[model samples]
Target chain A: MADHEHKDNEQLGAAGFNRRGLLKCMAWAGTGVLWTVNGGVPRSLGLLGEAAAAESHAGGLTFLQISDSHVGFDKPANPNALGTFQEAIAKIKAMPTQPAFIVHTGDITHLSKDKEFDDADQAMKALKQKVHVIPGEHDVADADNGKAYLDRYGKGTQGRGWYSFDAGGVHFIALINVFNFQPGFKSAGLAQLGDEQLEWMEKDVKGLSSSTPIVVLAHLPLWTVYENWGWGTEDAPRALGYLKRFGSVTVLNGHIHQIQQKIEGNVSFHTARSTAFPQPAPGSAPAPGPMKVPAEQLHSVLGVRTVNYIRGKSPLAIVDTPLSA
Target chain B: MLRTRAVLLGGAALSAMLCAAAPAVISGGGPALAAAKAASVKIDNFNFTPPTLVVEPGTTVTWTNADDSPHSVREMDGRFKSAALDTDDSFSQTFSAPGQYQYFCSIHPRMVGKIIVQPAGKTSSN
Candidate 1:
C-alpha cells in the first residue's frame, strides 16, 4: 500500500470505513470488488484479498449480482449467449459458500421474448439461491412497455417495478429506469426513473436510520458514465438525494457490460460485467455494444459480482470473479 | 481530463475510419409518387452517421443498427416511432411532406439527428 493509503486507513480509526482507502485502490480490475461492512461502515477489497475478506467475515451475509444475461442474443459478439448464461449459473453453484440471494441487474432477455424470459428463468434455476431482478432496456424494450416483465417480476414492486426490501439489516432497493424510452427514438436518451419512482424512493427510505447500509440495484448507471451512449440515468441526482443521509450507499448497475467503480462521499457506484458478452469500455469504441473477443478469451471478460455484508461494518466487500478465472 | 483526451482522440479516428457518409438518393418523384426514394442512416458507435440529412418529399429513410447494442428511432413530434432494434435490425419511415423532422434516440438522448424534406426542386445544402 502507498504511504497515503496507509494514512487513510489509519485515519479510519473507530469508524473503520476507509472510504478513500478503498476508492484510491479502485482500479478497473477485470475481477469484481469484494465488500465488507464492519460497525456500520463499508470497506472494499479487491479480488486478490477476497479470501482475507471472507475469512474476517466468518458468517457474514453474502449476495450475488449477475447482469446483462441477454439470453436471446445470437450474434458475432456471442453466438451462444444462452450457453454462457448456463456457465454463469455453474459458477454460482461452484461458489465455496452459497450466497443468500442473487440480484440480476437487468437485460435478462435479448428482446423481451417470452421464450427468452423462460429460458433465462430456467437457466437461473440451476442456482439454489433466491433471485431478484430489475429490467434492462432489452428486457422491457418491446411494444408493450415492459408488460411482460412486470407480469412476471413486478409482483410486489411499485409503478414500472421499483421495489425495496430489508434483508439481514441491509436495505436493498431495485429500481426500474428502463421504463422511459422516448416514444419514437426508442433507445437514444439516458435512462429515466421518472418522478413517481423517485417520490416513492424518498418515502421508502424516510424511516430508516442514517446508519443503515443501503444497496441500490438498477439496470442503468445512476451516475454519468457516458452521456452520448445513454449509459446513465437522467434523474439520478434526485434519487441519490434520498440516500444522502445514510452513512454507506452502494449502487450496483448493469448495461455498460463492463466492470467500473466510482466513489463519491458516502456512495460507491459499481457497474458489473455481463454474464453473456462484454461491451467496449466507455469511449473505447465508437459506441457501446457487444465487444467480440477471441472465442476462447470471451469468458475472461464476463463474470458475476459477489457482495458480502458484515453487520456493523459500513463497507460492503465486493469480489468480482470472472467465469474463466 | 485524461479520459476526455482519449475520447477526443478516438472521435478523430472514428470520423476518419468509420462510415458516417451521407447516403445517395436519386431525386425525381412527383406529388403522387409510386416508389419512394430510399436513403439510410447507420446507427453505429452510439451516433447517427450524417447527423443531419436532406431529402426530397416521398423519400423513405431507413435507420439500421450496425452496432451490437439495441437502438430505436423516434421523432420529436408524434410522427414516427420504432420498436427497439437489435443488432442488424432496421426501421424505415417514409416522409411525404416537406418539413424538417427532428428526432433523437430515446435511450440515448444525446444522440440527436435531423431530417430535412426539401420541396421538389430544392436541395439540402446544410
Candidate 2:
C-alpha cells in the first residue's frame, strides 16, 4: 500500500487507484462490502496533548460521529443493518475517551420507514446517551408535506430542522440541507436549509467568537466529491463562508458513504460512514443505489469517528477509526 | 455475526404488490424480490449505489467492474469471494433460496448492499 496517509493535493481517480496492503480503496462488488482506502494512512489526525484532558479544557468536547446508518435496509450488500449499527455503537462505547455526546450525520434509515427509524432508535437506545441528529435525504422525502422528518427528530432544532447548541463553550450547529434540491445533483443528493433556516443560522452564529470551536453536521458533503454525480452541496458555499471566520471549525457530513477529507483554512471537513451498507465510489458504478457484496465480512465496515475538542492552544482533533479494525 | 432476513409474506402470492415506493415492477419492496440485472456500484468515496436490490430466486446477481480499480463481492463468513475483477470485468452468484442476502466487497466491507430473494413464480400478497 502507498503511504496510507491521504495527501490533500494528490488525487486518486474516483475508482481503481491501486493501493497496497489494507490501505486499498474499498469498491462496490456483487453483494458484498469492499474496503477502499485512499493513498495509505487513514488521515493521521492530531490529538490534543495535556492540559486538555483534565476537563480544564473548558470548551473541550469529544463526540462520536456515525453516519449513513440505513436501518430497515435488507440487501446483499449489507444484510444486517441492525447488527452493523450495533457494531458501530459498540465502537463508540469502546472509545478511549467517552465523547460528551453523539452525532448521527444522516441516512438513519434506508427506506425512511417508521419501523426503520425505530430500528435505528432501538440500537441507539442501548447506548444510554443523548444523541444529536441531522436528517439526510432518505429521512426527509416529504418536506413539502407534514411528514417532514424534522418533526419527529428535530426537537429544539431551527428552521425546518437546523439548530444550534452550546457545549464546552463551543458552538455546535446542525443544519438540514435535504429540503430543497435540483435534478442531476443526486451525489450531494438534495440538501437545503430553507431560506428561513439559512437566515437563522447566520444570525445564530453571528455573535460567537471566531475562536470558539464549532462542529457542524449535515447530510451531504459541504464541498465537492464528484461534480459529475453532484457529489457535493449546491448551497454549502454560502454556509462555509459563514464559518470561514472561525479559527477552528469542524464540518461533518454523511451522504458520500466514504471517508474523504480536506482542510481549507481552519475548517476541517469529513464525510462519515453508514451503519447500513456501503456504496461504490462516485462514477465507479453505472448509477447510485444499494451495492451488493457477499454474505460475510460485513462487520469490517462498521466503524466510528471520535472528535475531541481541547482547550489551550491545540486545535480540535477528529479521528475516523473503523469499528471493523 | 452478520444477519440476513427470511420473511414469509403474510398475504397470498398472486398480484405483484409493491410497497412503500412507486408502483414499479420491482426494486426491493415487501418480503418478496426479483432477479438482479448485472450492474456496478459506486465505492470511490465511501457509499453504495442502488444500495438495495431485490431479485427472484435463482437469479444470478452479478457485480461488474466499471471503474479502473479492482473490487470483490464476498459474504460475511467468507462464504464467497470474487477474485478482484478489473475494469469491465464481472462476478456473479445465483440466489436460490427465498431470503435476504446482505453482502459487501470483502476488500472494502463498507461497500455494502442487500438482495431480497422472493419465492419463485410469486409477486404480490393480498
Query: Could you say which candidate leads in DockQ?
Result: 1
Give a tens-digit lDDT track for model 2, residues B1-126: 011121343222112222312322223222333434333444343344545555666566667655433345544333344554444556666655555445554323335555555654554222
Measured against the true two-chain complex, the DockQ scores of the candidates, in the order shown, are: 0.26, 0.02
Quantify all predictions' global Cα lDDT against the true fold: 0.74, 0.58
TM-score of every model?
A: 0.79, 0.61
Q: Specify the poorest-scoring 10-residue window by lDDT in model 1 chain A.
A: A22-31
Q: Give lDDT: candidate 1, residue A103.
A: 97
lDDT of 1 at A263: 59
Candidate 1: tens digits of C-alpha lDDT, residues B54-78: 6667788889988777777766643
Candidate 1's docking class is acceptable
Q: Which regions of candidate 1 are displaced past 4 Å?
A: A1-29, A37-50, A181-188, B1-34, B122-126
Looking at model 2 chain B, report the run of 10 residues with the lowest lDDT sum: B11-20
lDDT of 1 by residue, A40-159 (tens): 343554443446755744676788899999998898889989999999999889877888999999999988888999999999888888899998878876656578888999897787
What is the C-alpha local distance difference test score of candidate 2? 0.58
